[model samples]
Target: MATTGAVPMITLNNGVEIPQLGFGVFQIPPEDTKEATLVALREGYRHIDTAEMYGNEREVGEAVRESGIDRDKIFVTSKLNNGYHAPEAAAKAFEDTLSALDIGHLDLFLMHWPLTDGGYVDAWKAMEEMLQGGRVRAIGVSNFKQHHLNRLFAETTVVPAVNQIEIHPYLAQDDMRDFDREHQIATEAWSPIAQGKVLDDAVIERIARRTGKSPAQVVLRWHIQRGDIVFPKSVTPERVRDNFAIFDFELSDADMSDITALDRAERTGPDPDVFDYIPS
Candidate 1:
């Protein structure tokens, strides 16, 4: 396959640039994270997404520092865990993340989830203070729905730079993405392939054959074409490299429509509205 050496960069509302495609460390065991992340960097990934909830920040940071690439070249994002949404806990969690990663500063920090009745306004204030101090380049949310976002809009001072959510062929999240776009907040698709369920979908498989790419690649390409930032996870070495190769191909409008039409409003993860899990 021929190569085009650039991964697309999406500029957030605050004028920060983020690579449209990144390496996600969700569900990867802490022991395996460093090797997986290092492989991603070596294969031309300049962004990495990890979270305190994932229990892999230390390894992700270790890989970033050890990649032999300059630290400034990578865009790293991590989230505050669910238990830390209060103002004081949020503040402490941010420092804990920095210490765990051992990275001098963070490129992006996010509130991992909107806990039920969680004091997000206070958490947002804490995040805003961190942003003001210049340690975190950007602050955003994950698993946030429109209502959750609207609450922040009404009570907080800064707009979220990104909304990391569960989206894939079966759960397109069109409305949420539209709202994010309307507000200039980047929509980042997590579980971008529906957690491997869509790879075997007949529609996606057909497109994969047409594009001479794997089913997973086709789905990821669809995400990129739809203008959503995506980070597909794979610990398998070949698949890791394959996931990053989406930058070179183009999905046609018809293909995009066909994929979009396959939406079943299905989700591979918890719905933010009702999910109230607070990890210990």
Candidate 2:
């Protein structure tokens, strides 16, 4: 069995440590989330990324409890949904997340999006309060572009500990990753596989053939070599275990560059800057 020690830890700007590799529960139905999350936990994935919008925090919480791993040993992250950007609404939403997860406190909490609606600044303020109150160990923003982060820095005092964005070999996002690095903010890659779109690419396939790894594994290794944190979502038990097995190998510099050269700036998810839809 793999142990937590096998996973590399990345320290946040505020000194909180997170597993560089984790399990993400996005687009997972509530009923299946518990089983899939349990598989991940048992497979030695100590970090779990989830969002309130995913509507499965309760299941994630259930899995955490059932896994019998010490709560303190697990790094759990959840995000405030898009509709709850107002200060009061954000506060209530966070409280709801805590209740839903049934976890005493969150390891990390994020502003799910930089909503164009005028309330995001206030939402950030709420997150600041959550941090000071000790409800969350670290705070961050997801889907924030460089300009969005610039505005956030101007309006807030606590720099976000992380900026979670869409990154994959096909959409390397080098500039955004560099910007996050310059500001001491950790870059967390969501849709790290390009939603399976890059899995069939010839470049990634060639790297996979040479490395004796799956195309998904090669792409994941590329993200790891680039110093970006990634959590690939998979409901399959074998895949859950396979994803955790990446720490055993390293990617060559040339292979890393070749995979990086495949970037076309494509995104499988919404563009953060212009996406402002709030689901009902």
Candidate 3:
């Protein structure tokens, strides 16, 4: 059914379908989130991804409420912050996020990172409790590598349904994607355009020129063609609309290969292996 938006959705392991292309508010301020999210909604984006650490859940919720779109038609995603990994605090943290968002329930909730601290295993167990208790529809993780996923799967019964990570043409995380596929986890792409770095890349530009699309569109379309759910963030209304425009185009196999060849194992964000650097 194309999931009721310009972009289509992919079904998760738990049977919930999320919009494949989503609006993300990574560094946007709380005040700006409402307007930006409203703009994205107007631009035909049905999925919205935010996190507790983003500090704009309330504003995103306000925009969602004010948009007049039925709640069931929109997919809202938020993540648990790193500091709230302990089992005791996990549910409380979700409550706080719910309060801040002013929403009844989340479409998806993710553990922001897999930490070296012992709290993560407990946190995973708590997430299962919340899932069964119906506080969250889907539970997942972010910034998790295969090692982290292996450790998590070794100790926990419930496998994360999604793993949000830094994935773009430059940092495709192909190996991790294969591992997630083997484990039945969906790989969600954060910074799917390399935070706009690929906009000026020669390979992307070549494809963009040939396709009569912008470099950003080429990069985002690459993700769509690769079967990755990508949430690209942009505060500017035009850019928000521009990012969603990728749905109309399709990248060819050669084009996809060209983009894939650009992978450098480069990351614009933090390394997933170093949870110790994350703040308490």
Off by over 4 Å in 2: 1-4
Go through the candidates in order and give each one's C-alpha lDDT. 0.91, 0.91, 0.88
TM-scores vs. true structure, each candidate? 0.97, 0.97, 0.96
Worst 10 residues of 3 by lDDT: 271-280
Give the Cα error of residue 177 in candidate 1, in Å: 0.5
RMSD of 1: 2.3
lDDT of 2 at 72: 94
- Model 2 agreement with the true structure over 132-238: per-residue lDDT tens digits: 99989999999998888887889989999999999998899999999999999999999999989999999889888987899888888888879888999999999
lDDT of 1 by residue, 204-248 (tens): 899999889999989999998898889888899999999988867
Query: Model 3: per-residue lDDT, tens digit, 163-238?
Result: 9988998998899999998998998999888777888999889889999999998988888888899888898888
CA RMSD per model (angstroms): 2.3, 2.0, 1.4
Ranking according to TM-score, highest score first:
2, 1, 3
lDDT score at residue 54, model 2, on the 0-100 scale:
95
For model 3, name the residue pairs that clash. none
Q: Mark the regions of model 1 whose C-alpha exceeds 4 Å error after superposition.
A: 1-4
Candidate that beats the other on TM-score, 1 or 3, i.e. the better one: 1
